[model samples]
Target: MSSLSTRFWIEAAREEIQDWENECSYCKRAKSKSAIQIMAPLPDIRLDMPMRAFAHTAVDYAGPYITIQGCGKRREKRYLCLFTCLTSRAVHLEMAYGLDTSSFLNAFYRFTSRRGVTVKMNSDNGTNFVGIKGTFEETRY
Candidate 1:
């Protein structure tokens, strides 16, 4: 008693024409909204006086030098240098081994504990500075 074709049955059951529009998969995938519009330019910063006006500091680390005669045979030896101020460019340096978070923090504490507080301090994105996740806490002093 069933004489109707599969296509005729599907078309009758759909009840809407919107489902049959734009059958191309590529066209649908390629189509997207317009690109985002640009806003105003970033603001410029101005300094009233020279860089020396602010207590600025720069920090860097040097060397994992090879073992030397008379020096201990340790693989973690390194030098940490901190330069401060612009006029005199006062610098502080210390020798350390095992560049882990505790060692770095101890060295920094020793330096700052003696030299006193500084207004600004800058250092490159090193493991000692940024620290690894779940290994060390960020210092704020």
Candidate 2:
């Protein structure tokens, strides 16, 4: 269909993609006729832990959902900080006002006050998370 509509043939497009070596790796993978062999999921010992709720926690931030800031016509984007327990599969949600360390700390405070201290936490290298890591380390020391 694309070959009929566009000026170039499908083979030409494939050849063009092959010319860009970086893109061809992905294109070649997509064009392969063989059935995909997916690896089985790896097992984690932490998930099998006999522990209390919110013990082994994983923290991540979601979206910048638009919300009304104050009383009037002012609106602001907010991010949702999600805390989940690996062992119990329990979840806790907190609304963060900003992506800064202070805002993240406020949400962290709210989470800890409600759920208590967590044994382990896993999260991606978001700047907010990285900033607070030093604070947590200092407190521990």
Candidate 3:
């Protein structure tokens, strides 16, 4: 249909044919022919844990959004420090003033003080986290 339509005098025939081909079911099935299927789902280990909150935790840094300063017409960048319990799936959020180690430590301290010391913590290889981890290691030693 595309080649036949292009042979005629229809305006934008190639673009219309391309659009129709994109939404066509035959094109979709052709595209999925080489796809692979997943064999099985991974094991769920969250059910075997004792009734403890934040025993295993995953921590991540979120965003840097603008916030109003106190009693003044000023906007400052703030980030979210997220702490998630692996077993209970509970989340704790803390505001970070900046992406520095001090701010992250303050948030972490607040979380630990409230939720108790976590047994395990998982985080990505962000630079601020790397610094914080190094500082904690030094203090432990």
- Candidate lDDT scores, in order, read 0.57, 0.82, 0.83
Residues forming the 10-long window of minimal summed lDDT in candidate 3: 41-50
Number of clashes recorded per candidate: 0, 0, 0
**Residues 1-141, model 2: lDDT tens digits:** 466547745656655655775566776776778889998874473546855788778889999899986785888899999998887678899999999999999998899999888877888879999988779987972
Residue range 35-134, candidate 1, lDDT tens digits: 8989775322222224443255566777675445455554444555454443346777766655676767677667767766556556677887777424
Ranking by TM-score: 2, 3, 1
Residue pairs in collision within model 1? none
> Which candidate achieves the best lDDT against the true structure?
3
lDDT of 3 by residue, 17-132 (tens): 78987899998777676758986753354444856899888889989889989886999999999999888789999999899989999999899899998777778878888888
Question: Model 2 Cα RMSD, Å?
Answer: 10.5
Q: What's the TM-score of every candidate structure?
A: 0.46, 0.65, 0.64
Q: Which candidate should be chosen as best, given TM-score against the real structure?
A: 2
Once superposed on the true structure, which residue ranges of model 3 sit more than 4 Å away at CA? 1-48
Model 1 lDDT at residue 90: 72
